[model samples]
Each structure stands twice: as C-alpha cells, then as structure tokens.
Target: MFHTDCPAREVVDHVTSRWGVWVLISLRSNDLRFYELRESIRGISEKMLAQTLRALVQDGLVWRQVEPTTPPQVTYGLTEFGREVGESLAELFDRITQRLSPRDAG
Candidate 1:
C-alpha cells in the first residue's frame, strides 16, 4: 500500500489491482470486443469486467468505442497513455511470472 495520500496513489491502485492488471494486459496487444475480453481473461465475472473497464476508461487508460452498427458493436482498447502504461505493466507482469515460477524455487 502507498504511504501517502496522493492522486498518483489512487491511479496506481487502480492499475495494479488483480482484475485491472489482467484487463490492461489483455488490451495491450489489440482492441477486443466485450466477449473477446471475457474470453481472454478467464474467471472474471461479467460484472467485475464491466466495472474494471469502466474504471480504466474513467482514468483515461482505456478507450471504449461503440460502433453505430445494426447491433451496436462495442470495443475496448488501450489509449496512447494506456499503451504506455500497459507496456510497462506487461513487462512487470512478465517479470513477476518468471520470478515466481516453480523452476525458480531451487
């Protein structure tokens, strides 16, 4: 937890939350439809994913686009700022995974 109360701390909490990290990492590569995001990140409930996306959008870290088609297609992707942060998060995620892998327990 961050010791100081600052805007940056709130943003950090949002990005580093368990669900937030997965959402950001999933969108880092390409824009994804709602169902696609659900498929990409397993075990996340529809409610939670929606909430996560909404928070990211509010933070300007994610972009939500709605196509005015017959059914109104909705897609989510990383914004310019999001891409920067996503890339950094991706790297940190990778490092965390590698470091915590069973092979490293020796």
Candidate 2:
C-alpha cells in the first residue's frame, strides 16, 4: 500500500514561515478582513500578506470566508486547529520574552 509522509513538516514550515507566524498571531485576536490584516500587520507588503494567507489557507490553519455581498467581503480567522497552533506559538513567544528581558538584551 502507498502511504504519505508525515504532515508535520509541511505544517511547521507553513506556521513558522516569517509572515505566516505573524498572520496567525494577528488573526488570533479576531476575524479580520484582508485590508484589516494588512493594516494591523504594519510593514507587511500586500504581496507577502496575500502569499502568506494563501499558504496558511492551504495548510488548513486559516479559515477564509467570503460573503457575496456588494464589494465582496472576505474575512480570515484561525480554525480550531489553528487556534491550538497559535496558542502554542504564543506560549513560546512569552517564554522567549521572559528569557530575553532587558538584562539579557543589554
């Protein structure tokens, strides 16, 4: 029988990607529209945001919802799986921050 490789590698790559992590962390706050995410994540180029969102969506970490109303409203939010991933990353960030306080930064 044919079997596939572990999906962890891909998931890690997607979630840990430079923009991917920020996007996930930002979305952790609440569902955000495309422009809202762009604005919230300052200095993130439009191209990078688009690409990151696409990759996250492919990894099933981000849920993109589109409404057919005029002007077409699209919002992005963390899926249940993504929330778990985001929480883990958030904890890692907190630990790293605590480890690297002003004393360590100096």
How much lDDT does each candidate structure score? 0.91, 0.89
Stretches of candidate 1 off by over 4 Å are 1-5, 102-106
Instruction: Kindly list the per-residue Cα lDDT of model 1 for residues 1-106, writing each as its tens digit.
Output: 4667777787787898879999999998899999999999999999999999998999999999999999988899999999999999899978887788688743
Q: How do the predictions measure up, each by TM-score?
A: 0.85, 0.83
For candidate 2, the 10 contiguous residues with the lowest summed lDDT are 1-10
The digit string of per-residue lDDT tens for model 2 on 1-106 reads 1234667777787888888888988998899999999999889999999999998998889999999999999999999999999988888877887889788754
Best by TM-score: 1
28: Cα error in model 2, Å: 1.0
What local lDDT score does residue 106 receive in model 2, on the 0 to 100 scale?
Answer: 47
